[model samples]
Target chain A: MTRRSISLLGVLAASWWIAAPTGWTHRLDECLQAMRVNVATDRLTLDLDLTPGASVAGQVLALLDLDADGEISATESVDYARRLLRDVAVTLDGRGLSLHVVSADASPLAHLKSGDGRLRIRAHAGWDALGTGTHVLDLTNRHLPSISVYLVNATKPADPALLLGRQVRNPHQSEYRLEFTITRQDATDPSPP
Target chain B: MAVWLWASLLGVVPVLRAAESAAVRVTQAADAFVRTLNESQRRGVQFEFNDAAQRTRWSNLPVSMAKRAGLRLGDLTAEQRAAAMNLLRAALSERGYEKILGIVQSDEVLRRQGNSTVPFGQDEFFISFMGKPSVSAPWMLQFGGHHLALNLTMAGDQGVLTPSLIAVQPAMFEWNGKTVRPMGRETDKALALVQSLDATQRKAAVLAFEMRDLALGPGHDGETIAPEGVQVATFSAAQRQLLLELVAEWSGIIHDAAAQRKLKEIESKLDQTWFAWSGPLEAGKAYFRVQGPTLIIEYAPQRLGGDVTMHIHSMVRDPTNDYGKQFLP
Candidate 1:
């Protein structure tokens, strides 16, 4: 082969080689998108959408490797898990919401389980005032290295204007973004039914 | 030149791949232990697997016998409980496994002492394994219920099993007219190590203020203070041995080879570390502390249940490795 043709072939092969992993990863993204949160309630749910074929325990180990140490022993795993679960970010209309995350195997207030080929996460959000106005409930997954959130509001709102939220999901990392808007029955009313 | 670079890169890949394989093996061993459990014992293992959901609410401690076990032993059938214990034995050292059983039996002793109703005191033992048991990946073996919390982590070439919070109330209870001191020996060794230090070393080691417990609890962020107070080099030979003994009590919790490597790392830094104590050394009063390079051990004796001098709290931590130091970079 001519030198010019040989060089061109090498360039093409290198480009394909680098592009292969990204293409494969895109398929993984498609699999995760199938596990988005389509249901809504007064209580917020944060689903840990594991990648296709990824074991729940394995995914947890990967998330626990916050240091990207390539390996996570028992001590590091628990510490990372504790820190990740403890530091989860929950915001309501730009204000930080106080909530607890427990083991799915733990209490009736919070439920955790794996079914339908995904690790289902359900958590309750408490509010002191439920006024007849739009309120935003935002949840973020701080642990997963590369996963985006696709949120759908299962609870119908009184008005579309109350849907004051945006979807800013980032794939290739574990930060799923979702927002919920709660509208009161009346704009001036302080009570919520 | 290009060929050489590629060759070197390829050479490194196997090393990395081999390490990953080793990690998988470790995980499989842990999995084997889990797999051996009957549905009931498996349930006990599952109860403490705190995922994102359960952490959101204030859950109560395991109050009932069934709840405490997280799985009823009766439900396991005799064969399953034996299998579960065997799995534990396989995963831990003879000493390590025995210590766990001893601690569990000790908890039973405390429970039988009529101290069951007290809130925030010693109760049942809860065990959870995080990460698959493997030599390569990180994993944890945690056994803690009520006043006892043992957290051990094994990573590549290093293991940290500390912040081991062990507490015993009414330190000694009369069981069939015999005084039983379940957690006394470990405490006494630690206290003796502190007392062996010279006046100058003692002055440097003892914190000006006594702490009820190690300030670095589970959720605390960042290193609280620079390595200060007493240095191990200041101790005499006998005192240093005592210090090593004190640290070993916690290191002994893990049965893995990595535990010995961790002990050696702590031992090599013996001279640079410090041993400190607080409170009164007497049996009735609360007081004790030990600090070293890569190690911190603390103990406090307190009153519980109508002025009974029975409550105790102790903890061990690695200065450089707590929580994997994951916060860095």
Candidate 2:
């Protein structure tokens, strides 16, 4: 995208990480994390996108290349994939449930100065047999320690209502709690998703 | 209760003038550092104290997470670096300055460890000023980066250095010729003090669960937690002395005179101090807290990655006077 296209986003000057305790952080280095709850497949797709500054590109590389070699291997990708599992928390109602990664994969981070700001990692996750109704979903995400705000978005039967509370809860890091209720649009019709 | 809290925190309110008299040296040093900067650099180095966002915008986080301002040390020339250090020297004790350097050195070690590709070098830290420096007026010197933050607030001659966090990732490393542990003294002294507790004191002091992190950190200014631990009244005289020394280590982060002023204030209400602990009594993976009418200190061992006790985070704050509120309206 051209600088004009970037300007169209309505963000003047530079952007800040919305999730920061002080709400002060640059946009380029921040990773965009969104969660989409699916009624069609009883699954959630977690997408994490990062465009690191030249200074922070190396950290993304290290996460991809656990062995520190120039090239990323399948095993290293799997390792990075597993790390995502540990960082995110998904719960139905108030009860915490383990989320099984349906599939884990990553594309290599681009050049540090690349204004393209390509997607760093895309993860597709599924939770089977989730009943459909007006049920509450609480998302507690801790995937990126380097990230201040998770920028969590939840959508299911409809673009569900969301409530969020953020704090520096664990160690010196920030944790975000996003609570929302997803209702099957056709509540009159009982459905199993 | 409010009087005791303020008395413990702003004890230096009375001695502010005395400290200010000695602190003439610091104000002069700050002026000298300012002279070294050009117009553009000066604009970058200072902010109004009331920019509540800017005043609290500091963390033990990387540049990606924690945004900082002012002249970065990495970009400074040798002359400029010396000037900056000179200003810091005026603000911190001879040893306190070394501790800051030590924390910086540990960052370099973590960078070499190469856990992530992000920049974690000593140069990542930033320095900025809150308001202009005047002997009688209120101003603050805010400096920090990964694993370290120093907030020194000045009024008259009195100063409060609470609400600063000093921490390290590798916590232990080999620096220069010797093995360096930046947080060693705090860990060691705290451990010794807890061990010295007798059975009765231990029962009162130890909490049931582990304290995972600091209850009061950045953006948590002006908050308080109920004291839960063995009261200072329960300790013997020598044990009390040990406790005072531990508190001194945290307060001593500032220059000798300022640290002394703060320490003496805390000592006056020494009987009101409380010591608390959580997690296993074993040396590693434990959390400890010290609370009094005016002071709050916390040390938590983080379980980042596979290493449970390898990384440490700690903070010191004055609930009543964070960011020099005791000196302000």
Candidate 3:
């Protein structure tokens, strides 16, 4: 291994010495793939917080560092985020939604190797105003499933008119289904979507 | 109780000093604090304005885990300790000062319990400064230890209190015959707002999943998560009034004038604000957040110490102006 890579390995080992007692953190050996889904009146947002375990940091880094120069550039970061999102499936009422990258950031290689870094990707899909009525939204994650552990949650809607119902997740949390109803003020509002 | 009596005797209970702006009061109090310290103590607490690392060194952890950059309050003489509190009183509102004192005294309670391996209590708290105390030049006052951190940045008449952590252990305790809860108002106000929501509103207000801790607390600065929960625009006028009052529990912690300005900024963007909660209404052990275009406030009852409500962590940050970065060069 290169000296830089060796230094990272040392940092990763040292990270295990300190136990952080704050927030939602994954210190286990599996890669943590957590997603927060927000459904609004006009748009759908998916915020992903992906962190690779110390033992598997090398594999994750290789996937992010396209040029393998030991660093992830801005362009490379965006490209990797887009590539990951391709495996994600977001659907509303069985209609597949097209998501565009809103923001993407890859943490420094050293930080990632030490298990403290997170690759945050935010993707959004905007559509014409949804018709007022009950709707079903389904999300599936197929990104690095073999080595990844998944956590998916749907946020409370931003519009008070949008009432959320029970959420169902698969055993592995790779598949999530959300039920919601949009209550508009008047019958003149758009028909059931 | 003795500390409160001492503060009263010192005549520095955040009463208005005629014609003095908040910034002037803060700077004068800071200078006076420095004057009371010895040369070594001064060196220990002072830092250059551009010391970025020192500015972010404040943490809600024990001193052993996080080496803070300042003179420990425990190490100071009684006179110096009072001076330090006077500086805090000058920088915070009267209620804010009381809350902070309550948090510090809570640590002393922990020390009395003597269960932990590491040190705990008021003596572990530190007060540090970045840049000279000046009403014109930008400077920062950093104070924190165990479950509390106050980072106030000031310039001229402007002051920003962001990226601060307010937490307590034994969230409720008896102090001189009275029950003291440092974060009590924040808890009660939020519970009131959540309970006031109707069925449909509550359905939209609470999260679909559990949120055991803060989403944007310390170490997660400058990040704006997608706003979740019921929008403030949907609230009735009475409900909106309660929401504004809830927001004040955090924003109003700063000195009066600055707190008012901050509240006004928040109110102007009321249409964009969102309140999200996770956990049952009756159970006080819940996580709630008030997020807006400029403000993010999170309160969570930590799961340690058996009773969740006994250990709590709450954070307030202005995404646009944490550490007063907007005004700095």
Highest DockQ, which number?
3
Tens-digit lDDT string for candidate 3 (B1-329): 99877766886444333214777888889989999988998999999988978877866666655568799998999999999999999999999999999999998887777645657888999999888889888898999987888999887778889989988886889999999988888788888999999988898898766665566655666555556789888999898889999899889888998897799999999999999987778445888989998899988776532567778888999989999998887
Model 3, residue A168: displacement in angstroms?
9.3
Order of candidate numbers by TM-score, starting with the best: 3, 2, 1
Question: Which runs of model 1 end up more than 4 angstroms from their true locations?
Answer: A1-193, B1-32, B38-75, B115-123, B155-158, B173-180, B221-223, B226-228, B283-286, B305-309, B323-329
TM-score of the second chain, cand. 3:
0.93
**Could you tell me how far off, in angstroms, the CA of residue B321 lies in candidate 2 after the best superposition?**
0.8
Alpha carbon deviation, residue A16, candidate 3 (Å): 26
- lDDT sort, best first: 3, 2, 1
Task: State the displacement of the C-alpha of residue B47, model 2, in Å, after optimal TM-score superposition.
Answer: 0.6
Q: Please give, for residues B1-329, the per-residue lDDT of candidate 1 as tens digits.
A: 88767867888555445444434444555576577676756655653323322211111122231133333334454564565566556445667665555555555654554423432222334445654455655556555554555565556534555555555544565555766665666767766766677778877666454343333433322333324357777777888788777777776666556466567888888877756554555543545555665776666553212332455556667766764443223
TM-score of chain B of each: 0.71, 0.91, 0.93
lDDT of 2 at B115: 40
Off by over 4 Å in 3: A1-193, B1-20
lDDT of 2 by residue, B1-329 (tens): 88766865977455554466557978898898888888888898899977777777777667655567777888777777788888888888877887788888988886766645567777787788888977778888887887778888887677788789888777778887898877777787887888999999998898654455565655446545446678989899888888888887788988877788688888888888889987777665788889997899988786443344657888999877787888986
Docking quality category of candidate 3 according to DockQ thresholds: incorrect
Candidate with maximal lDDT: 3
Per-residue CA lDDT of model 1 for A1-193, tens digit only, reads 9999999999988886445331110112222321223212243433333322222334543454457565434555345435555656767667776654332221111111111133323344455544444455555554443432232222223343344343333432233344545454333321123
Q: Which stretches of model 2 miss by more than 4 angstroms?
A: A1-193, B1-18
Candidate 2: tens digits of C-alpha lDDT, residues A76-175: 6667766766777766556666655444444443433322232334454445544443444455666565643232322223233211221112332233
Alpha-carbon deviation at B294 in model 3, angstroms? 1.2
